[model samples]
Target: MAAGGRASGRPAKKKGPNKGTGGQKRRSLEGKGATPPAHMRHWFKDKSRSERIAREDRGGTTGAGGRAPARRRSEDAPEYIGGRNPVLEALSAGVPATALYVAQRIDNDDRVRDAIKVATERGVALLEVTRDKLDRLTEGAVHQGVALQIPAYEYAHPDELIDLAHDAGEPPLIVALDGVTDPRNLGAIARSATAFGAHGLLIPSRRSAGVTGGAWKTSAGTLANLRVARAANLTAALREYREAGLFVVGLDGEGTTEIADVQLFTEPLVIVVGSEGRGLSRLVREHCDVVARIPMQAAAESLNAGVAAGVTLYEVARHRRR
Candidate 1:
């Protein structure tokens, strides 16, 4: 046997599987750590749920360890109640709010303080976001350093409007908007409806204004007391009301009957106000039991949708009172 050579009894020792080389080859078989695709590297891929949730709570992380904000809650997506008075009044009126977002280092006026107090009392989540976030949420409107996250308004069914009147032991008196698109107009109509004893409001689900925060503020807190319903088809809804024994009265400048003289106003009535520019739609006019005009001083003049509805409601209320 040569010096420093493996000893063997009978045969020269074979190169015993090249121990060092074999180990190196085995290691080489395992490739280097490669980065995963961006989508595949989501935190949810982690087997441990707690770790995944922690990462998610921390706004999640990209493959490169970059952070991304979590998805917005459905309740906080749109429908912001901006302005100090709007936020405070919405809070005071018990409007369903998902969260109250106050700008960091706000002016801390009475309205802000009251809003915070009310939110705290109601257990509403209070989020402190940047002023820029508030501005974006309010869409460049004057937010007044505070904004409330309002969920979609829960609208009542058309039948519920009548039920409201029945509950009050009064004839069903509803104010239906044919195509009014202004939130402020809707708000003012709501105010007038509530004040003049109209039971509820009926707004078309599409191509019409809804009860937004602006409308809520314009209603002067009357929206809290009033039930506003959404109708998928305004003309069809009028027909349904007619079938239910309630008279449908549409407001237009060219109608044959004057609002004050329309006998239907005294009955279970649904006064339909048209759009600000076009007045009543042709199909809606066809559905009315009586298409009545708001008596005006000049033939050329036209009243605003809100004003016409208010004036017509006043006439109905007057007749009901007498």
Candidate 2:
């Protein structure tokens, strides 16, 4: 009767239809195998990458058109030589070098080797470095493998220079450069100073060339053998020299007296030469006790700085010798 439900206290089992969907199962399987969209791939490709990583991993472009910068080598760099004949000449002449650098490879060249040998003999430090090392030291200067560090030149007090002359047991014979900016001119003047037995060289600190390697080379290493003094104000220095019983003579084209006519040997004197382009500064000309001109052939308007100094020095020396 009612399927004998619970009449005998027994559990009854009922059966119903299953509600499973094949389409739902197929949809879930499709979601599991889904692929990334093309736009997503494009976005990932557009992301920024590390430069170093690109260079190492992907071979990216370098800054200089995909090329590395050129490297500089050392042998072309400048080196300094001190205490050698040239260095000593520059110092004694007051040429104003601060430090000297010598290359180790200098021993390979005869001239440089000899220069090093002498520098070592005089207790100067000779640094040895590769050509690349020297290039780094000079920072791309055309140092010719030799260079000298020079201080901002300072002038000895005019009084001190005069005193030095007196102490040397000789009359003060000083050569003053008015506006010579060429180191070669300075070197030549230094040579003349040494050869003529002058006391020292006087140069204006500003607008004047300090002793340099070019000057030293031009002096044929004679700058090391002379004394040089720099002046803050050349006119004032000249005035001081005058007060010290030294005649300040300016060499110019328009001079009242001839250099030959002046009696340079008997009195203490300071000879001044102007620049090659500009003869002399106005102030320097005014400070001179005498302005004398060197006699030259009409063919040449002026003499080279070195030649003119030599001539003047020779005349002074001749007069002294007489």
Candidate 3:
């Protein structure tokens, strides 16, 4: 056999251009197929001229409701608290978190250990995630190998607050916040409400602070024991409270009655606190049964919304004790 020949000793055939059957023609007889619609076609030039000129602007359209995804994350989204101490403190204070995330192979320190133990005892979800995933979950915060997910707060109706007090066989002393936008102030007021044995909280549905993670943390877990109600209209809710035989008291610096001198403690009450910037709105003041003030040494002196709430709650509790 030749050097590179096949086993049969035949020389290799050289490649050449293909030539088909010399007789019958088959596929050449077929006609051209119909073209698709311009809109359905994928090619740019094949598309309809109108479509090419006026392309759909997908920028402004968000899915069904058309609400921006950022709105979902704004006030109603579940919140995460990162860092070992924050997570541990939240757990220790009975913050009712949904999940406790521990980074994979995290350092087992006292806070992390206690957090895991307490979470386990409280029936909280203990999830193990990678450190990179934990970083994303915590949004680039200093996680320290731990993070806690807190659910969005659920609100109750204002009537439910009254009913809760009724079930407890006590006069309803609910705290109602007006124009207080600070979540921390809301939290501190909640803490004071819990401390002074108030029934629940009533806040305007809009232009007020709803419960948030900061409020939960500032409340020191006291929020769990308190119910919060939202009102579409503060004046309307106050009118309803009046109809239900609850005295509506507005705390204003320029009010006629002083907190110490006011004499309606034993009655069912809804104490309305205004914003730190503006004490009370005109309509809220008009709706209040009695507009009372906290006596300050100097008339110009003012207290924070939280301090004022605490002081007012304390005074109410003291007077009720008499």
Cα lDDT tens digits for candidate 1, 65-98 = 5547554435224577788998888888887788
Model 1 misses residue 17 by how many Å?
Answer: 31
lDDT of 2 by residue, 198-259 (tens): 88888877888866555665676566556678888888888888877888878887788888
Tell me which residue pairs clash in candidate 3.
none
Poorest 10 consecutive residues by lDDT, candidate 2: 72-81
Please report, as a residue range, the 10-residue window in candidate 1 with the lowest summed lDDT.
69-78
Off by over 4 Å in 2: 1-107, 132-155
* Best of the candidates, TM-score: 1
Per-prediction backbone clash count: 0, 20, 0
Candidate 1 has an lDDT of: 0.84
Q: Candidate 3 versus the native: TM-score? A: 0.73
Q: After superposition, how far is residue 312 of candidate 1 from its true place, in Å?
A: 1.5
